[model samples]
Target: MKEYKPSFLFRNAHVNTCFPTFFRKVEIEYRRQRVLLRKDDFLDFDWVEKGNSKIIVLCHGLEGSSQSHYIKAFSRYFSERSWDVLALNYRSCSKEPNPSPFFYVAGKGDEIATALKLTSEYQEVVLIGFSLGANKVLDYLGKEEKIPKNVKMGVAVSPPCDLKESSLLFSKGWNRIYEQYFLKQLKRKVIEKEKKYPNILKEIGISIEKVQKATSLVEFDHLVTSQLAGCSDAYDYYEKNSSLFHLRKIHHPTLILTALDDPMMSEHCYPREEVKNNVWLHLETPQYGGHISYASFEKEYWLEKFVFETVNQFQNRK
Candidate 1:
C-alpha cells in the first residue's frame, strides 16, 4: 500500500474530514428503485446502470443517504468504469420517512443482506461502505453463512470497527461538535416519528421525550438503538454489532482502510493482529486522512482513486 501524503492545505485531520462534506459536489443522475423489506419497511436504491454485468453496491455512513458526497462521488467513478452502481439508502435515511417507526442502527448488517439479495442476478458484485455502513459491510461479510456466489468482495472505508470505543469520543473535546450536530438531527427525526406514529412508537418503546433527553450518541443508542435492536444497552449493542469481532470470520477478500488520525475512531478500528491472521482481510491505516476524508489534487479524491485501483487489482487477480 502506498503511504498517503495529503496536501499541506488539507493535512489537518478536521479539514480533510469536513472539506468534501462542505465544499465538494458530485453531479450525476440516478434512477430510483424501492425494495420492500417485510411489509412495513423498505430500502431505496439510487442506481447508475450502464448495462454492465458487474455491479457495485454502496452503503453510506451514519445519517448519510445515497445523496452523501462519498456515495455520489464513488457512484460516478464506478459507473464511469462501466460498472453498474447502486447506492443504498437505509430505511429511514431515504427521503420518505419509513412507514415503520424503526430507524437504522450502527450494527444493522442485515440491510446489506437485502441489498445483496436484490443484486444477486448480476455476474459480479462489489461492496463498498463508509463509516457505519462499513461496519455493516463487515458484519454481513463476516456473519452471513450463505452469501450469493455473485458477490465478489468488499471495501470498508473509515469504519469504526469497535463501536464501544468510538462511542466515547462523542462527549470529548472538538468531537462534541459532531455529536451535537448528529444529535440534533436524530432528535428531530424522533419528534417527527412521534408525531406520525404515536401509537406504534408507544408499543415499540420509543418516544420523543427520551430522544430529547439523550445528549450524546451513546445515550441515544442506549435509549433508541439498543431498544430497537433488542439489546440490553449501548454496550450490548456495540458488542453485538461492532465489526471488530467479525473481521476474523470474513470469507471473501475484503479491504479495510481507515485513517489513524480520524477523530471519530480509536486504535480499535484498525485490527492489525486479526488481519495478519486472516488471509481474506486486508487492513490499511494511513498516517493521514480523517474519518471519510482522503483529499487529492487530482480529478477525484485519494480514496476514490485508491478504491478504483484496489477493485481493479482484485478483479484482475488470478
Candidate 2:
C-alpha cells in the first residue's frame, strides 16, 4: 500500500535529492507560536489549524526549518483538506537562538513531545517526520512508555534510524558533499550559540574551536551531540539513541518509507526482520525515493497522498 509514483527525470537518487530543494517553491501563511520548553529554551511552531478535529505534526530534516520545501508542501496539502497541520521548528531552526546552549541533534523525542503539548487534547494526531526528523519521530514513539491516547499514527521518511552506521556512511564518497554542507551550517549555529553563551561548550568539556575543526559527522557528534545527550562519545550516543533499537516498542500503526539507494542508510536502519515481527511497524522501500525527495508532476504528490491515505485507513478503524 506504500507506493510512490515519481517523475522519470527524478528517478536518479542524486536528482531526486537535489531537484526539489533548488526548484520547488511553496508558500503558505502560518500563525507562529513560540513555545517555552521546561529547560527554558523556546521552539517556534507554525500553525495552520482550521478548527479541525484531526491534526498532523510535521517535522523537518537536519538544519531544516518549518520553511523546508517538503514541509511546506505537506502543510499546504493537509491544510487544504481541512486537516490542521503544525510545523515545529527545532531549537535554533527559527529566527532566534534557543536560550539553552545545546540544540537537539539526535533522535530525542523531548522537543517533539513539548510541541505536541500545545495541541488540543481531544484532537486526533498524526506525526510525520523526514530524515533526521524521521529518526526523532520513531524514537519518540518507541521510547515513550505513555503515548497520549489522542496520538494515533506516525510516518517516518528517509530515516537514518541507525545513527552510528549511517554517520559512518555519511562520511564517505559523494555523501561527503552533503556532509560538508551540513557541517558548514551546523558550525555556523555553534558559533552563534557560542557568541550568545560564551564558554558554554567549555563548561561541557568541549571547545568551540574543536567543534568548528571537526571534519566528519562522527567527530562533530563526538564533540557536541554526545555531550549534550549525556553519552560517553558519538558511538555511544548513536548506540543508545538510534531509533532502530526502539522500533519493536512502538505501539501505534506506524509507517517507514526509505529509499534503497539513500546515501547514508544501511541495513541496520532498514531491517526486514524487525518490520516482519511487528504488526504496528510498516516498512516500505520504493527502490529510489532518494532521502525524502519524491519528484512528481502532479499537484497532489505521491508521498503526501499515500501518507494521507494510510492515516485515513487507520483513523477509520478508530
Q: What lDDT score goes with residue 255 in model 2?
A: 93
Q: On a 0 to 100 scale, what is the lDDT of residue 217 in model 2?
A: 82
Candidate 2, 173: how far from true, in Å? 1.2
lDDT of 2 by residue, 132-227 (tens): 999999999989887788898999998889988998988888899999999999888888887888876678787888888999888999888888
Where model 2 places Cα greater than 4 Å from the true spot, the runs are none
Residue-wise lDDT of candidate 1 within 73-121, one digit each (tens)? 9999989988999899987788677878778877745677888877878
The TM-score of candidate 1 is 0.97
Clashes of 1: 0
Candidate 1 overall lDDT versus native: 0.86
Q: Clash pairs of candidate 2?
A: none
Query: For this target, which candidate reaches the highest lDDT against the unseen true structure?
Result: 1
| lDDT accuracy of residue 14 in candidate 2 | 81
Error in Å for residue 18 of model 2: 0.8
